[model samples]
Target chain A: MNEREPGIDRRQLLKGSLALGMASLLTPRVLRANDSSTVTLPFERGRRPLVAFPQKRPLMVMTTRPPQLETPFHIFNEDIFTPNDAFFVRWHLANIPREIDINTFRLTIRGRVKQSLTLGLHELQTQFEQVEIAAVCQCAGNSRGFFQPRVPGGQWGNGAMGNANWKGVRLRDLLQRAGIERDAVQVRFDGLDQPVAQATPDFRKSMSLPDALQAEMLVAHSMNGEALPLLNGFPLRLVVPGWYATYWVKMLNDIEVLNQADQNFWTSQAYRLPANPCHCVDPGDALTDTVPIGKMPVRSFITSLENGGTIPGGERCTIKGIAFDQGHGIDRVLFSVDGGQQWQSARLGKDFGDFSFRPWEAQFIPKPGHTYALQSLAINRIGESQRFGARWNPSGYLRNVVESVKIHAS
Target chain B: MIPVWMFLLLLVGATGFAWGSPANGNDREQGSILNLPADPISFQPGPGNDLASRYCLMCHSAEYVYTQPPHPREHWIEIVNKMNASFGCPISDEDMTPLVDYLVTQNSLQPSPSAQHVQRDDLKETPGQSSTQSGDPQKGKTLYGRHCVTCHGPDGKGDGPIGQALVPPAANLTLLGKQSDQTILDTLRNGRPGTAMPAWKNDLNALELNHLLSFLRTLSP
Candidate 1:
């Protein structure tokens, strides 16, 4: 990733989804540093022989505490569903709570609903059906650090996104019970993410009327089958499936239904993307337009051995990696065993539920002495394939380029 | 000190239990507060801290900082120089000696230890089997493809796609055995500690790190 600070270009809608991937397996706890901190080691170390499980270790993306850095960008998880211990955290304010008493905490859901309701964690669990999905939560600016020219935000790499098996009550269900007013046009979620301006504190976001009603939307309180990891927007968070995690509000203290869309800077002025279809605008022409980045375009990469790989003859190889598009799933994965010359469509494994990731594979029989060049490309049902570059957006939002690999048979 | 607005806002928000309010979690999180006394936390640096967590972990993690294996002096300088130039670390020329001293000593694996100090860690690093068992070879193959191949070439021979990104061009893994296991471990874990090599602890688990190490050992001359 080039490390030049290219100031924000007014060109495309600023919908640039970049998370400067500064890594470290940090959770919210990392940001909520109180006077002194310590960790009590896991008592059952003997039961866990290696205390260190270092297989397929994912790299960490680092981001600093705000005041130390600003939001719009921050540290991110190397993986899509960041591990609880390693979720990148970024907030605009310096004063953050070290801990919020669960007993005293509450998630208020109010707005244009038939009935205004107050719900408790246990009540939430007992009353509604618990639905879980492994979806990725990515900041709007995930990978902003890689913007050929730098921007003034948390310079993230690819780590801000994280996948999680979120469990919680459905937002749709809650809205229905609240009796969403007949005229309500949008639903807003204001987090405990510290209101930027106290005088009029405004750090709010909302989903459209239809999205708020979708079944995939959730008011989650748990991650990875455990109580929500604290740094992961614990107490409560919004998990929006298949969408950028920016909408996944953490420490959600308020959920309000409104008759109109939120007009706060967070929405109206921020997260906006170009409404045009200019993927590869000339640098000169690129200097003018800007737009909001939204709905991550379809993209995939072969996570298995990178572009240049070498294996002894007749080696059985398992090709692995992940792919993502706005809504449509992975249609087919094509492999180019004989370099990028000829192509063969490899079999994609079973589909993991709706939005969760499914591991795909391709087995190849190798020959000795000569090296093989392999590359993989994914296409959705609509038949759109991942490209080498999504075209240079000044913000460098989506780069779902196809990944290639080189293999040698000794 | 508690900000009035924060405390007041929270109090009102918490107790305002209206006619229909959501339930509070009541989840007793004992270890929630960072292990610190009742005081405000600041991102300030400390004195004689010797490799403070802030300076090192800003880019890596504490887990990476603590468990690192040690390295020889020259290799350490190569790392320090890299971080200062490549990764944007502000390592002053003055801080070099002490920083290196702390790392080389605290993280040092004494070839001259009191022999009785043999720990299990020593056992694991002693040139284990050749099967690439530390991590899922399948996973490593992919990770290598994604990360390692960028510099180590397609076949661990040091010619990679991102190889050009490295100023000195990436290290030739097949030849890392010249250094001891501790040196190799320390470098990988701490990322040359303060250099561009980046402490890799956050990205790799010990096993995965071990497997990558195993793979690199195979690349040695």
Candidate 2:
């Protein structure tokens, strides 16, 4: 719809096309100060989990408000893992870093480390042990819509999660290189993508020293064995497998080792777990204890046979989904047919590697001509039981609730 | 694929509300996160909204407010007031009652989601004047180019950075050039009353204003 606008020179067309991953960079346009021009404002995909997903070639369909997948997800092209171009694109800001000039990009290391240093993209790629982990990064708010009280954020019915084989240097090795100073309490992270707010640009976050220096932590550079997508933090991003996608700060720039944790809002007073166990209470009654949104709470979800799903009655069909608790691995996945009554153990799949998402599947022959409610739940070895409903938190933190799928019979 | 099943949206909020199935603390919601226990019960004044968003979203986009949550209201209020005081909320003592009325009526008492709530030491400082006249095309183009291009297209169309997300979109800058100088100047100095346009009186100087206004006049579309 935009390329047709009058007077937008070929240069602007080139820029717009490039942003849409359409054209290649041919020549640079000299940006004039007084030239009134339109820029790509960040179109936040709050209405849908993934705003722009390719349904057909050259046919870039934009979702209404926030884009949502109207059709049920059917597994196709499953053989060679997720196709490169068909991979999902997730962005949090409009000003996504277009190009990563590995030349001057630097990663600063500070805080509870013996020495603070800045490493370039090239250094990040070549200096440490290059390892690739097939993991899935999901926004904590991925299935936030699943929460009751119709909490408003991204009305993502699902779609916010994606599995990727990420390549990068181990964060632990880098931390050791910086030498964690004694009394180190936490490690903080910030991105180069400055969110220009009414206030100054403060697009940043932090992590505990243990979480940052964990063996599984990685400063990723590639996804599905390719250079990171510009929107996915081209040069680098933090890969906190098994945890919510929040800590995976993209366009990674700063890594601080704090002897005494940083007092930033992202860490101190925000992104915390609930102070109560139920969704019924005065939020003011709950003590606002600022804490880290650590290891994703153990949870499970049904990928196949989605809510309101339909299947041929009597046809033997398999119910499937991927589930694994971060840190404390998943020991068992349970499936229920009668709304949590009579739970059956689902067949577990082979582990796909470290800090990576494991896709689990369970099969069942549906009763001919019967609409059944299907539910999948997982329990981490830590004994965290995935519940059936969600609770209320001031911030809506950690929705590890067990998700239910409604299957319809034809 | 998007899940077809309609999920429950009526979540318990954190703003100390007294609704729905009484709040639960030290107990997990049925079918929610494992035995690890349900998150603390929250009561946002807005049932559909959580505290973090209810407050912050009033002035800005919900996407900006909710991406990161669990912040204290002080910080939230700081952000709300920041946009109101610094970015451009356009309210005075006279309008304060209406403004607060709109806010207090909100289910959320937390800060509104808005542009950054940056606390700058220089906000109280008076703006410096520009060198160019307000209508000089060369000067106007130069000034407008720097400040207007992000939301308004180079040719004066509404296609800048924030323009795409706006409801009515931004005004076509080039078209404004045809309007009276008084209208243009007033809009520039005080900003369009109901838009995302900030008061340029603080960000621009007289000469810069002249140049921006002049360039804006040239574009007919």
Candidate 3:
């Protein structure tokens, strides 16, 4: 059931209610001593302390205020689905909601619609058909740290990605209930997070009308079969499968049907890649044209072994990793031991969905006292495969170069 | 409504409950709350340290700047300007030059030994007099407002809001004027263990610590 309060502006109601809800919430409990533990990523200026946030393991902390945390790379080897506690967190705005009361929480749909409808969590569950899909949510700058001539952004190692089983209702069903007007060109999504200052642009993102109606696009309430952690956008999050995590707005509560194209700061100025197909330009070259970053390129990682780690000497070791693409379903994964000079097919583990991370395993026998450069290449069904050389872009987005790990046989 | 077969499938999924299984109806029904940890890092103290703290820490912790790979002064300038023009950071034009100076000195890509990696033992062994030059209390007051007031109260009573949350709370600085400069310097450079006091050596230079010490003496009752 949808509710409409008469003579009330939806935007003002949302803001007023949010302020009241925040005021009534309990004071956040500060944790004990700072952990002071640290993990050094394999780059200069890569040493980061390990800190535990609410409902999280001690992850590599990128920043503390808005709480940008990265999943430790080893978590990927533990299971195919990233645990809810260890899923990476990133918030664009500083003043994220520390508490959410589901009783008052509403998912509001307005703008260019037949009628604005506000639905609660319970109605969203019972009134609509439930769907579940597994997908990888990856940051656009996941491996920005490894970018040569290092870019100025979140310098994350390959830990800014995680695969999860997202459970919720379809976005199309809700938009249909509100009845999208014929002139609707895009659907803009907003969340509970707010900028610290009034002058800062509110974090908002938009998708084309056609893309919003896709079956896989979900307003996910559950991650990995459990309630999402507060940092990971509990209550609700938009799961834009196959797209960079930038488009997957967290703490999602508002959906607007826009008659005109959105030129919001986030959509227009930020998270953009070069306009070229490769989405790249040479280093030191100024970008002449740009477009909003979209679907993720194919990427694969060797998770079981760490770089500069030792493998059992003169013996066969099982090498395990994961490969994912823009929902095209990985057709084959090729493994190379001598730095892409030769290749062999890795065994695919399971098929969760086209969008889910596909686990792959291979075997390697190394000689004692010698080091081998191991790399993995994934090719999706549409014939898109990773390149041997990395493509350079100013923002350091869509880095799907064949990843290499140098391990010695001890 | 879910069909009977799909309901059975969900039941099966719940019973099995492995990593990759589908939804099992165990999703949380109530709203959640989070108690975030306090920031444990601070900006490197220098000329424009106060301005950097006022403008930068408004949106994020100092770790964002600390963790970045060293860049040229021009890069830092561009980043600072972008923060003002694009991200709506309200840094004034007059303050921008000094702020850029602070960033450049601390995070320059030049081939100099990193101040962050200097060993605690080496710092302890170094002659303390070199850093104990005559300090300016006025400059120290500005630095204190930038860095310490959040945890240590404005009156140096260790009664600030965040300090109250700590296990071994922030120090009462008013009582420390009688202590030797070296002892105070060591405490500021190498933070007290088993407490919330973080080391300032990586963030504040020797002279800045001396200035802070000079200001702390003025708070004596």
Pairs that collide, model 3? B45-B203
Off by over 4 Å in 3: A1-36, B1-32, B108-221
Model 3 lDDT per residue over B84-105, tens place: 8888777778889999898887
Residues B40-86, model 2: lDDT tens digits = 11112333233222223223333333332333434445445655554
Candidate 3, residues A1-410, lDDT tens digits: the string is: 11223554433433343343321111122222223456779998787666556566667888777788899999999999998778898887777776688889999999999999999999999999999999999999999999998889999999999999999999999999999999999999999988764567899999899999999999999888787777788789999999999999988999999999898999989999999989999998998899999999999999999999998888899999999999999999999999999999999999999999999999978999998999999999999999788999988898999999999998
Q: Model 3, chain A: how large is the TM-score?
A: 0.91
Q: Alpha carbon lDDT of residue B59, candidate 3?
A: 66
Query: For model 1, how does the per-residue alpha-carbon lDDT over A368-390 read when each residue is reduced to its tens digit?
Result: 98777677787877888877543
In candidate 2, what are the lDDT values of residues A249-359, reduced to their tens digit? 888988887777677755665456654444333444454544556666666667665567688877678777777667566778998877788788998776776354556
Worst 10 residues of 3 chain B by lDDT: B12-21
User: Which ten contiguous residues of candidate 1 chain A have the minimum total lDDT?
Assistant: A44-53
User: Which candidate should be chosen as best, given lDDT against the real structure?
Assistant: 3
Grade the docking of candidate 2: incorrect
TM-score of chain B of 1: 0.37
TM-score of 2: 0.61
Best candidate, TM-score: 3
Candidate with top DockQ is 3
Candidate 1 vs candidate 3: the lDDT winner is 3
